[model samples]
Target: MQERTFQLLGLLGFILSGMFFTAAGIKSGDLLTLGGSLVWILACLIWLIPVLRDKDQER
Candidate 1:
């Protein structure tokens, strides 16, 4: 349960940070900011995969 919460937190952070990065990119037109957002998005997906698997396993 703790691990699941951590995973959820990670996902939330990634999404929120990604939005921040996207906003920064839109304001400044920075490639680095966009890249960072992409990285965070990938991390969120990675974290989500395990959670999905765990749910299936539980069922």
Candidate 2:
């Protein structure tokens, strides 16, 4: 259950970054928002590391 929550949080972060940063980048007309969003995605993956470790252990 906790692993599931981690996965969900990462997925949610991706969706939010896609929507929010797309708009922010378009409106701002720069790479700043878009570039920062990539970092946001990396952080989201960190949130899911525990789930990934579990999957690796299963194999």
Candidate 3:
């Protein structure tokens, strides 16, 4: 797969994680949702960081 695919998935995951975070905020007591969002954000970073590092190397 292309690097663009990873970049897109990372962005999508980040957005979805934000939405989950908002939901967690509204719910207040939902630790599960908050945890899930954190994990999602981590996964997104795992994907995005490599792409970003490669970009920086190019520059």
List CA RMSD, all candidates: 1.9, 3.3, 3.4
Error of 3 at 51 (Å): 0.9
- Candidate 3 CA-lDDT value: 0.74
- Model 2 residue 51 CA deviation in Å: 3.6
Q: Which stretches of candidate 1 lie over 4 Å from their true place?
A: none
Per-residue C-alpha lDDT of model 3 across residues 1-59, encoded as one tens digit per residue:
88767777768868687677958755897777777777777777677777777777978
| TM-score order of candidates, top first | 1, 3, 2
Q: Against the true structure, whose lDDT is highest?
A: 1
Clashing pairs in 1: none
C-alpha-based local distance difference test score of model 2? 0.74
lDDT of each: 0.82, 0.74, 0.74
Candidate 2 residue 27 Cα shift, in angstroms, is 6.4
> Model 1, clash count?
0
Worst 10 residues of 1 by lDDT: 1-10
